[model samples]
Target: MRILFIGDIVGRSGRTALSSRLPGLITEWKLDLVVVNGENAAGGFGITEAIYNEFIDAGADAVTLGNHSWDQREALVFIERAPRLIRPLNYPAGTPGRGAAMIEAKNGARALVINAMARIFMDPLDDPFAAIDRELAACPLGEGADAIVVDFHGEATSEKQAMGCFCDGRASLVVGTHTHVPTADHRILPARTAFISDVGMTGDFDSVIGMNKDEPLNRFLRKIATSRFEPASGPATLCGLAVETDAKGLAGKVAPVRLGGGLEEARPGFWP
Candidate 1:
């Protein structure tokens, strides 16, 4: 199975980039599943029903969320109805919508997609490791599942990497999101999971991790905050990880996916 995991979709530019490029990438890579992090899909806050549908129609097999999952109040209802959209599993037990789901690929391969947020540098949440343990136990690798991808929504790279190692071999891919900056550590772990510290944001790369640079620059220079964070109006970059998984739910190869206009040298896809 070929899986593409896109990072946080910032605002309009992010959506526009996704709408324009995803379909082509899906065809070019022959992707079996596409998971998008939509926590910031709506004006750098949360996802809306309209935006959610746009992603689905644009070829997203599943949409994952981060800490800002509830920023858009409307998502509460939309997420519940949309089984393909998932919030962090570590969220309080009663949180609306589920943290994981099974999405069937074009070839009828069942892929288990799980989303979990880390506690470090974020709000208190349930033990993600334990939460995932139960999930994997319930739907163990193979047995019928072709692949398992985990969207580790987190801030600290240490936490994200820890989760990846913890879930190595158990999951087909453990890609990180939430810092909005792509990390260069894309590789197949010893346990066979395609792992990356952070897949970055699918928005304007010229700005501060997709937001306008002025506000972040000001905050860094002046001790106090002065301006609101706004999405950068520029050519967007689609950032994510592309991985090829074997039939037994293990990653065969992995690479960082970057497209459109953006920073860093990027290419489409490669086997290694």
Candidate 2:
């Protein structure tokens, strides 16, 4: 199975890049499944119903979220209606949307996507390890699901790496998000799970983590909020990870994808 997992989408710049490039990627790469992290799609705050629909229209089989999942007020209500949208599985028991979802890929293969947030330097949530373990146990890879993908959204690299190691052989891919800066550590783990500390954000790299430079700069210098942090308007670089899974749902090949805008380009060699 060939799968692509895009990093966080921040506002218009990210959305534009994705809208323009995703269709072609779906064809050129012959991707069987696509998942996108869209928690920051709405002006770098939270996703709205429209943006959720937009991602789906752009070819995302499932959309994942992070701490910003509820920044947009409507998300609290709309998430219940959007089955393809997944929030952190470790969120409080009564949290609105689901933490994981089982969706059919383009080829009719089953893919289990689990989105879980880390607690280290992040909002305190339930144990992500246990939360994801329950899901993986319920649907064992190769037995119940053809593929398993885990989006470990967090700030600490250690936590993300730990999650990747924790889920090693159980999941097909374990990629990180929320950092908005792509790392060069995409590799298949000893247990055959594809791991990357962070896949980076799909927004402008010219600014600070996808936000306009001025405000974040000011906050860093004077320590005062003069204005709201807005999403950068410049062109964005779509960032993500591509994985090819074996018949047993273990990752056989993994590569980082960085295209367009400011960052240097990268493509999976196996695709061609």
Candidate 3:
């Protein structure tokens, strides 16, 4: 199975890039499964139901979230009805929406998508490793599901790497989010799971982590919030990770994806 995991999307810039590029990429790459991290899709805050549905309509099989999952007030109420929209797995017992989902890929195979938040310099939550272990045990690859994708959203690269190592042989792909800056460490682990510290954000990279640069600069210099942080409206670069799973549901070929905006364009060479 060819699975693509898109990183966090910020504001209108990110959404525009996704709307314009995802459908074509799906057809061009012959992708079987697509997962998107949409925690910051609304004004660089949280995702809304409309944005979630847009991602689904654009061919996303599962949409994941992070700390910003509740930035949109409506998300608290609408998440119950959005099956494919997954929040952080470790968010207490009664959090709205699910932390994992079993989805049917475009190729008609079962794919388990799990979203978990790391707790280093992040919101305190249940043990992510434990939560992930339980889910993986229940819907293991090559048995309960044909493929498994884990989106580990966190602030510390160390935590993300640890999670990747912990899930190495069991998951198809384990990619990081929240950093919004693409890293060059994407590779298949010893156990065959594809891993990356971060896949970056599908938003304009010219600014400070997809936000308007002025505000961040001001905060850094003045140490005070003069205005709200807004999403950079410039052309956005769609960023993601591409992984092809073998018969055993382990990752085979892995690559980075960056297109448009300021980043050098990239695509999975194997796909072409």
Question: Is 1 or 2 the stronger prediction by lDDT?
Answer: 2
> Estimated TM-score per prediction?
0.96, 0.99, 0.99
Q: List the residue pairs that clash in candidate 1.
A: none
Candidate 2's C-alpha runs over 4 A off are none
Better of 2 and 3 by lDDT: 2
TM-score of 3: 0.99
CA lDDT of every candidate: 0.89, 0.96, 0.95
Model 3 residue 97 CA deviation in Å? 0.6
Q: At residue 54, what lDDT does model 3 achieve?
A: 98
C-alpha RMSD (angstroms) for model 1: 1.5
What is the C-alpha lDDT profile of model 3 across 106-125, one tens digit per residue? 99999999999999999899
Runs off by more than 4 Å, candidate 1: 268-272
| Candidate 2 C-alpha lDDT tens digits along 1-272 | 99999999999999999999999999999999999999999999999999999999999999999999999999999999999999999998888989999999999999999999999999999999999999999999999999999999999999999999999999999999999999999999999999999999999999999999999999999999999999999999999999999999999999999999999999999998
Local distance difference test, candidate 3: 0.95
The Cα error of candidate 2 at residue 43, in Å, is 0.7
Which is the leading candidate under lDDT? Answer: 2
Q: What's the lDDT for residue 208 in model 1?
A: 86
How do all the candidates rank in terms of lDDT, highest first?
2, 3, 1
